[model samples]
Target: MASLWSKISAVLPLNEERFPLQFGDRVESSVVEMLKRSRRQLYSDSPSASRTLNAQVILDISWERLNTGTWRHVDKEWRRVYSYGCLFKVAALCRENPSEDEILQAVRTCDMSFLMGAAIMENILQDVVQILQSEIRKSAKDEDDSEHAEVKRIKIASPHVPVIKDQLAVPRIKCPSLESFNTNYLLPLKPVILEGIIDHWPALNKHSWSIEYLRTVAGCRTVPVEVGSRYTDEDWSQTLLTVNEFIDRYILCKDGGKCPGYLAQHQLFDQIPELKEDIRLPDYCCLGEGDEDDITVNAWFGPGGTVSPLHQDPQQNFLAQVVGSKYIRLYSPEDSDKLYPHQSPLLHNTSQVEVENPDAERFPEFAEAPYLECLLRPGDVLFIPVRHWHYVRSLELSFSVSFWWS
Candidate 1:
């Protein structure tokens, strides 16, 4: 409920003159300008005729980092926010030239700079913690002051029923339906290990995809670009051309290196043509539904160089691995006692804890948090309910797919 600006300022040492926390059009404009400048290639290379049409789809997503006011409207707010690297992927292309699948794949795959953004945010949190320490030290001598006395008060509720580590270790079983899962595990906000749900999906089966098939389905395929002379860098792009072109560029073509196994070309819906129409699960009577219908196909393409920091999804989700391997680290929603999610509507309000080396002094509750380690190989899908915190690491240039529905 406290403001991010105030909370961050309390912990980090900062001068109002240097880093003023203000929200207005100027800040929004700055973000717009930042995105525009970053898309230099897209403007220059993309065909001039379709530039306006293409730009229309570039929705002005009002994220807290870009617009503080938009964040304020959300119930939850987080301190220490910063964004680094390219926010969205863009590439150069000639006019009148139809956008190629390679271009689109490159754009999707290249939006990986979010990892760099995470590190920048951590620095901001460090500054906040330092400020809090200084304030505490100053109040140590003022015992009689009510403000000082209140600051000294610490709330440490005891756990009446200690949860055994072994008990928590047992993997959960998948319910017969989403309604059962919600009634059994969600209403109370408890975490459970799900089994068999992912094992039954066709995509998670033991079938190896062809080079051509993987490119069409994976969404983020890269195109090769020429280097000095011997080799060229990859020129990423996207277009809805025939599947044959996809295989030609990403599957069949070889650079100075070989393609990764998980990066194969595969079509998930080809096997289940009915899926293409229902790529995203539509609303069903039994399962509770969210406001939006756009909850079907949510996929992530983290190639050799991307990592999703510890964060949670807004809705219940089923993460199915189509190709490649990803090391998944998950924290349950109730563990929010430790992860510290923002009470905001801006879906991705995450805690500022550095998972690699959590500071016990700053986030003491993390000590009580339980974590689960699972490696998602091809065909293994992990079920993550809303608000469950998790982090992902691409083990070997992975390609993973997920299906989400309301």
Candidate 2:
């Protein structure tokens, strides 16, 4: 326990004299005073001093913003405050001899990747997971009288059929040179499946992902989950969950015919660098108009029956299937009228007519839309041109990575 506390103390910034934060510029005077009041009352000479500066106060402000529906548009300075608050609070909680459950809860409650502290959180999580995993293994071995205990494994697969009949299957091509791919597919603004690419990714080969391996590496980390069969439903909502709990509830168990849980369109790489190291970025992303940093990478992991309603993305997308299959149908932007897009501004990019179960009376014209389809499997990368409408459904317990570039 002393050693664990020492490791956590070594990871934090400790006392750098940045206490009593003052965001005077562009910050309201009232908020600035609140920040000052949140400072640590103790001036500890120990290197493992509490880092809980502004944590309590700023967290309240952030929570209020969440309840008021203004979290998305909150000022950047406020986000900076929130990030440090969460970061320091974790250090403070772990300062004492915290058990594994306490440590997990500490990390779970702290929201990460808000703005300024993404890289720091990545490092902190890696350290915490490593320490806890070592301790857990030691405990398990001792429980078995110094013998290895065989862990019972569950076979995970999707019960629902993920296939959909459509007019055309997207063309498949071996990965081409950047210039050749740009001239053929990118120039024509066409969708195609690139095969034999990403075969070298560690996720596909070495350290290949399994349920047990995932639980060991990232089970305790917190992530956003979309809770529903589909995001278009009235009951659809987003909630924060630990990876361990998500796996136990969604992946390890059979689908209960209720809403499915999914981690979709989240920048998980920014929070957990260990998982990020397993996949490589495709070279084709450079053909777009931005530098490497401009590219957007999102992780999509879920059980079967998870559906992404027909929608279009602003940038070109490469959906890389890592673990399981996905049945996909796509339509061009010219057929948006036939697709019956939602009238609301929030859903303007999404279609009102469900691709698989279209309402005949409300969306009679949707039947006329021309579309292409594909069954993306492991090592398969599907390219969707900018503004190309797409509907996706996971075939089984699936983990996919998508990169979008403009």
The candidate maximizing lDDT is 2
Q: Candidate 2, residues 1-406: lDDT per residue as tens digits?
A: 5576676556544654644365647566876665544444323433443244455666666555444545566666666556555655565666667677766656564435332233333345446545655554444422242111222323343345545454588988997889988999998999999998899999889867766667666776778888887899999998877787887677655445364889875567766667889998899998888999999899999877789999999999999999878899999999999998889999999999888888999999999999999899899999999999999988777899999999
The lDDT for every candidate, in the order shown, is: 0.42, 0.73
Off by over 4 Å in 1: 1-170, 174-182, 192-212, 216-286, 290-294, 333-337, 340-348, 360-364, 404-406
> Under the 3 Å rule for N, CA and C atoms, how many clashes does model 2 have?
0
Collision count for each candidate, in order: 35, 0
Q: After superposing candidate 2, which stretches have Cα over 4 Å from the reference?
A: 18-22, 27-54, 65-69, 109-167
* Per-residue alpha-carbon lDDT of candidate 1 for residues 346-398, written as tens digits (9 for 90 to 100): 53356667665678898888868888766665645566667778776655434
Task: Give each model a TM-score.
Answer: 0.42, 0.85
Task: For candidate 1, give the lDDT of residue 214.
Answer: 42
